[model samples]
Target chain A: MTAPALKLKSTALNSIHRKLGGRMVEFGGWDMPVQYPAGTVEEHVRTRTHAGLFDVSHMGEIDVRGLDAVAFVNGLVSNDASKLVDGQAQYSALTTPEGTVIDDLLVYRFAEDHLLLVVNAGTTDKDWDWISSHRENEDIELRNVSADYCQIAFQGPDALGILQKLTRLPLSEIKYYHFREGEVDGVPAIVSRTGYTGEDGFEVYASPDKAERLWNKSLDAGNFGADDGVLACGLAARNTLRLEAGMCLYGHEIDETTTLLEANLGWITKLNKGYFIGRDRLLKQKEEGIGRKLLGFEVTDRGIARDGQDVLIDGQRVGQVTSGSPAPFLKKNIGMAYVPVEFANEGRAIEIDVRGRRVGAQIVPLPFYKRPKQ
Target chain B: MANVPENLHYSKDHEWVRVEGDTAVIGITDHAQDQLGDVVYVELPRAGDEFVANESFGSVESVKAVSEIFTPVSGKVAEANDSLTDEPEKVNKDPYGDGWMIKIKMSSSGEVDSLLTAAEYEDFTKAENE
Candidate 1:
């Protein structure tokens, strides 16, 4: 007989999500909402024009402390963490010795010996194990703080205004990629000026007990009473927003088999930072030249190209689509795929096997959409 | 609760048919559209294409997924809803009327009688959802 399936874990906001009429789905071992009653399109558009609140508590957080914390973290990631000052965050990736990405994460420097690493939900256990094993007699201490905190992202053009209504701190003073410790709705929290939607937004981290109160206060401050007010968004809207921004999803764009260089993330891989995991392999790959490169494309034909669909050049299969969808805001079908370096140029014509039909497409620049400058 | 017209017929796959003499208008049920979230694209069969009963005639693409649309009876496509090519969201706005997907010249009007009635289809979907 087959073993029974394990129950999916729920975040602190799970009950609130259900109360708000969110449709629950299993995502990366977590029972998360894919969309609320307003649906994905409304939530996505509202996030672009107004604001959207996201419960990102499923994402993992790790605390690193000790005299050698900075050095230890720098030795594991691809980006230069040494450049970050107190209260600043840097986007980086954990790579295996073979130069392939283990996971992309955010590193926050709270002080000289204290740092916080925010990682993807699915890779939390693996990331913890990997980072713990690499300590190897170092005096650093690593603690998985995922369950201790809940993360909420308030994103979009109007995010700052909505967030400022609840806190006394001058939110405008918090520069992009910087964070501050403040009380939100009478609860101590970490307010970071960062988001994945390529919009002006802020991510708030608070203790689990205080998370529900913060969520409720933020929603009330947003005041969804007006049609243009803040909307409660879900994972579906999050996926589309990040895709339009040309941000990479862990499983879709980067994985253990995909290297940083091939994924067009070479700028973050600092070879001269003096020896890190995957440094030698990445150096060799850089010298030898990358075989394939990730390219973004817009569907010129009728149908939408989905993930795992075949990409063809003159009817000959060359590559496969990693992620694709109808960009609700742009009013076009867009997707990303890995193709040979020769075919990575923009404006190049190609065909995607959308189902059985060969649909026409054109190579386009990364970031299918960008927000207008304020 | 989804709208289910008492006079029309429905399929287990969520399609509904309004029979008018020998020609039948087909569209997805209201529950189908709601489940699909936002309809982005609808791939319809060309006029004059033939399909047997229960055959997949086209697909409807939504923001989160793609759902195959099947025919309830053997028929030839008389007309495809051209407006959906540019305005697929009409399915969500008016699934029973303006959102009709195709007009099929039925091989036999009697075939629809064998499909689910409004009451039966409602019961079917109720069980499916549960």
Candidate 2:
């Protein structure tokens, strides 16, 4: 492939990746691993059944501190920020005045007056500039801590067990969508109960200096198991796992042109709360149902449906797929698409046009596969 | 690493065509599985299916990308690998051994000679590396 227009940035583990025979691809301006020597399927299966390690250092981290941090952040995003307790995290969308999504991010209340926002890698610069330009007072200090931090994800049933071995902090105490700052391997780290995969996993945020050490330590513990406890996964398996977990990617599932209601993220919108940038538009959407909505589908036929493939209902095109792949956990082709509201219901039968032929599909509730209970 | 037997004729697309009497047993090469990642689903061509040279005969789905498995030579498919229905990952685990896709009756044996030699395929990939 020709060199990308933008420089493909690498994580701390880039050298480690090259040594492991990873097929690197340019993804969102990041020169990330697409697959390893074991291949995408095995890495995916390992993540679902055992544990998989991922270097998410490319994602951006922003810290907001000051007495007015809560109020300052509350006016900026769609979610109710005041309701988040210390150590709690919530998914929120930053939007334009017209209610178009700027980016979807995770907001963690680290202290009574401080918050940490994790933004997407590709849009980090934009998000940072947007937030910076809008800051009017010293009451809120916005710091782009992206460069200083590196993240390692241990996802699957055995993730917690492996993580507990390294941290003196009680791993079980951290609830889902929450995080706690503690020391691991003598390095200050933030352990979060958040994972894209729908499994009991933890995302560890440590300094770049300590990233490789933490990763090797996690691998050395022999967590995934007869061969190795953990396999280093790539962006390929990460995308599949998140899609299987019914998580929405920022660009594909929701963008500046789409609203939360249309993106099926209405649960994060609160009308009774203090005002935010897109509150009025979201309230309007609540009063009137969205015109088109995102829905999940399972391909019953042979072909694997892909992004931009047309979704047909009764021989007429109804929508288009945003993200589609062969679901490893389900062992079938599954994806998410944006369709007319009338056809967005779960269990509705539909057809997807693969190449030229129509393939039988069913509009299933998202997260086509959930990890079997531990 | 997967097994790549020396006796089989291989194509650059990572397919091995093992000549057996009047039929040729075709399967993906070990390199193909290494490239494909995890094998979640496979779309096999039906028996008696006619394939044109270099045209897609089937498709294999991994966690990330879907790749079309192309025919190395023009021929009629006699039978598909029945074992793939339940053990699709066999391609990844042992491409040359049990992951064979079909048995094809060759339309032209001349086409087989044009396919890549094992050494040539390896060199082709090595040259393509970043």
Candidate 3:
């Protein structure tokens, strides 16, 4: 007899996504929308020019609160959590002892004793287990609050204008990487001025029961008919948007086999911030130099270089593509690859084995596309 | 529902062929374009190239994926839709008309009879979607 397939979980906005004609797909064991009726390209361009609403409820949230929260949490991740002030958020990662990444996550410091760690959905259980195993009788309290709350991201240049119509709070007061508690559509929510897309936006966290109301109200405020109106974006657009911004995806860019230094996340490694998990190996790698580096490149020739495609230098495979797609906003095919350090220089000629044919490409600077200043 | 012209012959791979005497124009069906989302690039075979039935002659790349286009019948390429090289979105806009990918000189006209009719192709797509 064959084993039955595992059922995928759904977010609070699952039905809402279906109602909006979202094409559902399995992502990290969760049934999420890959694109809506307007399509991935439209949603991608909409986010760049106007605004886009994203159902990010599938992400996991862990609460770390207690007297020793700051010190304890600092010891668990690579970045210095002690630098975070109340209402501030820091992008950090949880790594193993060998200097490899467990998962890239956001660390929010509500207070010295109260902190929230927003992690990727697929790694929630593993992250919880990793954190628990490292507790070792510490005074910090850990609670998995993922199931209790739902998250939505409203992103774009016009995101602030649309979101400002929903909540009475001064949205501008919340600076980038900062958050504020406010009522969205009359439901209590934690609104943070942060997003994965390279655009000005806010992420709203609310109770699961009130998620639908917030989603609908935010869409209504966006006025769907306007050319620069809001769109219900899905995971497909999110992937391309993040890639064009040169942000790393957990499994694609940094996994158990890849370290922070090789992933070009050395800025967040903080080797000299005292001893932490993976500190020793990271320090050693820093001194001896990394063998490979993640470099962003644009396909100078025809064809898109998909993930797992080999990066070739004179017909010899040096690395593989981590993530790649047509950058809709930039109108160029771009991707990131882990290549040898010598071939990581900008303007270096390279080739990507797209399908069976070799396609010409050139190493470019990170962030294939950058949003214009407001 | 997608537009499936009853006059055209379709392959299981989602390509549609419009026969005109010895020459036949080929392009992807509306359903195929819909599934592909927004098309960004199209790779077409060079004119005068020969392809066997069910052979992958080219590929259509969208923002989400790359789909190979197969020939419905063995033929020699007479003309390729050069317009798609610069404006691939034409495939998404008018898959049946200006977005047509190629015109082929059929090696055997009888080969078209083995392909699926519009009704059969529609049923096939419906069942596959389900």
Candidate 4:
């Protein structure tokens, strides 16, 4: 996420982020805000305790139309797109022939013939090219509609109540993993009850031009809820939040080398659905048993084990940490790493080389934090 | 505008030093804490450890990133701020006071001459930011 050779792109709410005193940084080749004035930890805690607004317009969206949509998409991804009924969405990934991930995405089934694939921002162009090039006399109309919409995540415990005030749609009726087309603050948008922060919330997609109105009105109505108001969060909080939820961030946890099972995404990879890209590789791996697994750990001693640190055991490099950061809510330095399946058990002693300093840590369960049941 | 007290000298590395006779108290500056966001953890050289001027003495960790805290003067550690081990946010709340990382028993007092004064440090930070 350093300064790229190519010019950086700005989201629809870039100027508004600057106006709100957001600390902007170069993320995924886009000028993105990493944190607002409220700061990362506070913004993170606020989202868990109440609500937070996030502008995720940079995430790419592709519309799959025509009669062969289901079959075409099923062949391209690991998840069973055929299982998805209209108005439902499923977490999925696009993989290569070797069973390694190209990008993790959400498959939103509008109908059997119509669907939307939401992809990571940095891999949008590459994902489109991969999908379009796989066409073989299929009736699929693949279109990358990334620029045609603005996505906002309204997330937290009270996100449902707060966002309900801005729209006439019955927000409660939109179950988790389900979406509905509705008008919010007079702007037509697609509202879903899904989120990355492991909370009860919604991710709304609207026209780019109407983003300012939706962003402003949503923040202005913060007082309509409890005290402290909804904080305008940035990518930093989003990263920590998703990590705490044990969600895999593309390029970090799962890459072009890690398999779906090894990344702890076996639930999403439905091999029985049949004849998908990477299916044979995944099937063979599943039958042979995975050699390694992604597991969570907490630093028992001082120092933080950040990303790219070495995960060691008995002074030998066993694996490497993929995602490591402070879990603000858990109040602990935690991370996830790929280690031998035998060493992935809970409470296994491990060491992480934090800048050549071997720090003591223990393998804990996945999801360093989970929201309480309502 | 970050508060740059006229009483202390500063380093180009965004650390500040408050010298009292041969003993020097050091911590990251207000601007440094602001740029680092929330201070979550700090790793400092233990007492009796020695360091040379401009050398990395310890590290200050925030939620998103970590930064090395450089020594402004050559010295042995009189006392490391053990309080920061439990309450690191003091660095963000009071970078000049309780957030102080270490007190150095200075071996080279003239090393302070190479450090920037309050006015110069302010200009240095402003220029570096620009």
Candidate 5:
């Protein structure tokens, strides 16, 4: 069949990916690699065991500037932005007026007067419009900077030590979820100590013009003298790693119809921070306790229970699985879904409909496989 | 892709069948494994299960997606690869040899000729790419 006529949005590293023999797939309108020839399992294991490089430039980046940027951004997000010090980052959420989530994002405080918002790719346009339209202060400037920048993530236990070897920036000085602008290999970059994989990693942002070169540099360093140096990961490994880390996927766990509290991301919400979008509804939900809570599960049978599969208890559908797969590291099928708060505890028995058969499953604590401390 | 031996017959759905006596050893082609990402699980039919030609017998789960395994010819499943439960990645490593999914007692040996040759399979995949 002829390739679809739909134009795929290419990132700065598209040509580089093609050069690397990446199997390309269209994801959320962007032509991104789903895996390299070494494949998704190898990439997933590499990220956990050593280091893996990923081109996440398709994710939307926004810049909030001007005098009241902090206050303006804080008022629009669910997290306590006032607590984010300069050069630090915080996971936060943008909510609808009804307390449903607009998107989960990471807010990096560049300075007291400037902030950077990294949002999910599929929800970037909506997030940008929501934040810009709700800006009460005219001093704040919200610009969609996604096109102007590229994000390359090097995630694994050795990520920091490897990065420190190339940068003058003090690696230990930067705490988790923090950003520091510095020169690595004499190249300008913004190094953030954060990652989706359950390992210590850094996300570096650089100019699109220099992104390809920098990506090559990182990949070269990652694979230095090894049989398979830095492995290029695709969306498949990325999803598994993030899900293993117990992080929520935007449209799956949290979306336009689910509040942060119900999504079990209330830890990021600051109830006492006064007003923010959906604050009233979130506060009410908190007081009443979430009706249905997102819980993690592992299949005890052979079948993999995928998204939209019914989660049953005693032959009745009690909840529905949101996301699931066979975890490469754990060698077991695991997933997350919304279940009644009473049945959300670890070790609770649940049945997943695998085709026409109800397979045995157990509610388990997330991070099915955590990286061993180095 | 790895070599496609001339003795093997291929199906358009990317499965390869090798006839040894009255039984045929069935496995996916190297090109199929290349496209499926990494094999994590292989769900094979029981030994006694019977399937019609072109019908799905089981599924192969990769890290990326789960694809059904189509029978190239109607037959009774003589044996399934139970070892795949713990080592599905073997299919990704050497799909033609140790990665074989099942052994079937062929209902009719004549059905084997209808399948594609190695050259035909290569051309088929190339045309698919086009």
Candidate 6:
């Protein structure tokens, strides 16, 4: 069930979505579209093959400005923020002192004194409170600027070409996980070459009031109405794409109790940097092996395993499904689950309790789908 | 707008029933299939299995969710659409024609009268959508 529409918040493109026949639903207490008339599977496929535009303004953004911006952020997050130069972004998680995920966020370093944090919508308030409460002996100024910007995710293989028409900032110059500030369709925006989908794309961050114009311009430039054109996607399509990409979502793959090592995010956890939040526990866990590890699997039986279902081995519960869905591009029933470290191999046999039946499945590699390397 | 067949009866839960003699063929309504988007799987009850009125006998899975398909009038399952195991998309392509789910030997033929006709079902779905 969802919250009533009256209590939910909407982004700047709400009216446009209604006109486009989007199926509106409540997500993170925001009245957002879950899918459009193109449907979830088709939208997912379109994003993989062509292009898909998404209204990601619901993702929270926070600005941290001060001489100690990078140091302050590094002390709280799991990544080594000091390594970032201008226009670089990294995926990091805010962890408790004991090494638990408060939320997973993207850290963008505009300069040594300026940074922007893009957090999940549902945990925005809580994350704000956590960051604000931790301010001590730091000269950083934190501002919650989520409502000031409309973040548009233009993802797919063809997205770069479509967005390049709007600006002359040498879109090809921006490397992956990097961004450049410029005008898009004559509107000032941050054109970031980053995305959640397994395809190369750009995410434009512009003023909230300018959302409609930019959205329309991108569609017009891409000739959205034609077959094999750009699609206006919603949250459902975004979720499916991220799942197939082997990306983790907050509250599903990592929660307050799930550790970074257990979630297989060792690449982002900079232990050699210095003492930070959750470092000691991470050190301890490193010395003593983790009990469970996150792994990927595909349902061999004719069924789909949803989140919160039990994963079994020999009809005994050993783990739980975290995120499960149809990998539209891959044409398989895939999901992520937390299983015992002993059974986390790539070819381990597992069963998922799909409702009342134990559906056959086997542990596989991390990404069920990956874009071809250029 | 959904296509409501005049020769069939529909339950409030959106299952269509086509009664012929003591056996009734069942499938989901077009409205249900449209709301569900692209169907990926359909789990039906095995033959000889029994059910009562309003009992959930099977489920239909879309790309994102799985919805229970309840039976309006219940009886022993006489036949099931086993072909759906390999080709579930047929439920979306031909919901009423080739995608019929199951056939049950009705225990009480009077239950057929309780379902709404095509006209009544159309009105009911219109109200529900609004």
Each prediction's whole-model lDDT (CA): 0.93, 0.84, 0.93, 0.92, 0.87, 0.92
Runs of candidate 4 exceeding 4 Å displacement? A1-5, A224-227
Per-residue alpha-carbon lDDT of candidate 4 for residues A229-257, written as tens digits (9 for 90 to 100):
89999999999999999999999999999
In the order shown, the candidates' DockQ scores are: 0.47, 0.45, 0.46, 0.52, 0.63, 0.51
Chain B superposition TM-score per model: 0.97, 0.91, 0.98, 0.98, 0.97, 0.98
Query: What tens-digit string does per-residue lDDT give for candidate 2 at A1-374?
Result: 34578767888888888887888988778888888877676777888878898989999999999999988888888888899999899999888876778899999998867999999998999999988887887588889999899999989887887888888989888888988999877789999999888888988899998888888898877444545478888888899888888889988988988898888787887768878888888888878878899989999876788888999998899889999988777777889999999878888889988877789999888667776764
Which pairs of residues have clashing backbones in candidate 2? A39-B37, A40-B37, A40-B38, A41-B37, A41-B38, A223-A229, A224-A229, B14-B29
Candidate 1 ranges beyond 4 A from true positions: A1-4, B108-110
Give the distance in Å from residue A159's predicted Cα in candidate 4 to where it truly belongs: 0.4
lDDT of 4 at A124: 97
Which 10 consecutive residues of model 5 chain A have the lowest summed lDDT?
A: A220-229
**Better model by DockQ: candidate 1 vs candidate 4:** 4
Q: Which ten residues in a row have the lowest lDDT in candidate 2 chain B?
A: B121-130
Writing each residue's lDDT as its tens digit, candidate 6 over A180-251 gives 999999999999999998899999999999999999999888885667889999898999999999999999
lDDT of 1 by residue, A199-285 (tens): 899999999888788889889989857688899999999999999999999999999999999999998999999889999999999
Residue A112 lDDT (model 5): 89
Clashing pairs for model 3 are none
* For model 4 chain A, the run of ten residues with the poorest summed lDDT: A220-229
Error of 5 at A227 (Å): 5.7
DockQ winner between 1 and 3, please give it.
1
